[model samples]
Target: MPLALYLLALAVFAMGTSEFMLAGLVPEIAAGLDVSVGSAGLLTSAFAAGMILGAPVMAAFARPWPARSMLLGCLMIFTMCHVIAALTPSFAVLFATRLVAAMANAGFLAVALRTATRLVAPDRKGRALAILLSGTTIAIVAGVPAGSLLGTALGWRATFWAVAVLCLPAAVGIATGIRPAGRTSLGEPDHEPSLRAELAQLRTPHVLIAMLLGALVNGGTFAAFTYLAPVVTATAGLDPVWVPVALMLFGTGSFAGIVVAGRLSDAHPRLVLGIASPVLFAGWLILALCAARPVLLLSLIIVQGVLAFAVGGTLIARVLYAASAAPTMGGSYATAALNLGAAAGPAIGALALAGHDELAPVWVAAVLTGTATLMVLPSLRLIAPRAHRVAPTG
Candidate 1:
């Protein structure tokens, strides 16, 4: 891997940590901010909404700038928002800061994918992207757990402060370590993709299938994960202190899964998703039925982490492969779609918790996961023939 990509991964790791660590600290955040826990959970939803809205918007703006500069600007925004979040006294201010951070995250990732791909030979783009996305996976495993611990030990404010501090290094890494790939600036490129051209990518059954499946899979995963704390504490009968540890264990599975998934994706994208889809489906099924036992609950969760992430690398690669026209724009749309799922997951899970409190979340997650697995049928047919094929020879 190139040094530039490594630095970009570090920046992404910090950003991913900040985005995901909130789940483990939702109760604390709600109490500290004087908001309902549901409202505190909206902090996560708000970020996902920002990503859903901001990815395309940023991609449009970034069309006019060099990729390197655009990434730097995005990280700067991310860093500043963390600072604002760390210092804010009121819940409203904190909410606003989260939006800013989300925008930065969405935009940076959209640009980073295109930039990272260009940094390597055409044949290596898949591997490069896999490496880049590993940062997000790594965050799930290590950064979020660490952040949760920090939030638990010192006030959640201290966690945000630490995240703010990380931006300094990330910003410097982008400034000095990352080098632009081509003479033609990312902003000034000719043959700009029209909105019509970009939208047409969605019309392709393959692209649409990939997007929908990505949304479904992510929705299912988040539906269960969003309420993980309550499930562990209330359902699994775990100590409050053990909640974050369970989350960390889940993250550990996710990190390992991402690495393994990346290789499997490069080799056989279709088979990887096909095999993992059922595992995820089964994991949720078990969680829904047997969540009463603490040990069984933890085991199911670890399995969920592994199975849920096992197909991620394949899914992202599929989007890029299926969308032949305006790949970057199409890819950004997929990113938006994934965020849309993220947004929907918690909202749906919370709604399910409205009347029947105890069994609602698990039932909701099981339904979503089952639905998601069924949705994969179309995507499977779409990619099966070429599943094991290598990158296109440019």
Candidate 2:
């Protein structure tokens, strides 16, 4: 229950809002900048590229620094990027700002995950991370819709300005709440963070499977989530208004799922992952098959969201668990793996959309998650909380 952890979550909320708000504003941004919707959509791609590439690199370079300093620096850079984006009238400038902002976002996520674990006891790592990731799920539920409303009432640039302003309290809170560099809220380590030692963890069986599980599960989640608008309205034949409602429901389910996973995973990590993974895949399969049924489609989306995060979030925690010896790189591994899934999932969905219908994304999601279920056996041991870890003594 550290103040710094909540501050970090607050910062994530702002960044997560910025990351997803574009879904609602793409048409407005396209019209304002005299670009096609297709072109504007590439901004999402740029952000994903930055996150996928920047996370490991940023974590590696900043590994030696205090997590508190790294977290604050990333927040400042993220706020500045939003300000520049809000001021820019040109598409190029806006695109550049998003790419840079995503890098800062990646850095914050990597450091924050590592720092969150350190702030609490070893056994409560899952809960600590769940608290931090709640910012993201809450962003999905409220922030994206609010951003769209703000854009409609004012303009797209207003949303950007709002994101910039949102970072201010987080900055101030982080500055005051987290103690100074040495032995701050970010408990000091016994030695310098070694990037080489971190990379060596990749060869470990538990770490590798955990990363694979995260990538596949999260990829499926993103594939379905990215196309929810079309799946709900166009495929299920619901009204356009159902789009936002559906998103809210999904986000609500996500929040519930992650919280449940956090509360239960420490005590029953194997049971949580074992049940959530296959169930998520089955949910996707059912949705894909019955996508035309309005009632089923509506009901399954929430279930899908629940299973998605329950499985995905727990796997991410396991990655950190298996790589506990490599604290600095553990966060990087989780960040990079999830970002990789986020990048690939949407691309697969886009390809499906180009050739097939909106429901194709659901099918793609099912396949991705089914593959994840197949890979679960190897990851079972690594996903559990350590039964016999000894506390560090002075």
TM-score of each: 0.90, 0.95
Query: Which candidate leads in lDDT?
Result: 2
Q: Write the per-residue lDDT of candidate 1 for residues 199-268, one digit (tens) a residue.
A: 6666777777677777777787777877787888888788988777777778777777777666676556
- When summed lDDT is taken over every stretch of 10 residues in candidate 1, the lowest stretch is 385-394
**Candidate 1 lDDT:** 0.76
Off by over 4 Å in 1: 24-38, 123-126, 181-192, 387-394
Q: What TM-score would you give candidate 2 relative to the actual structure?
A: 0.95
Clashing pairs in 2: none
- Candidate 2 residues 108-159, lDDT tens each? 8998898888888777777888889889999999999999999999999999
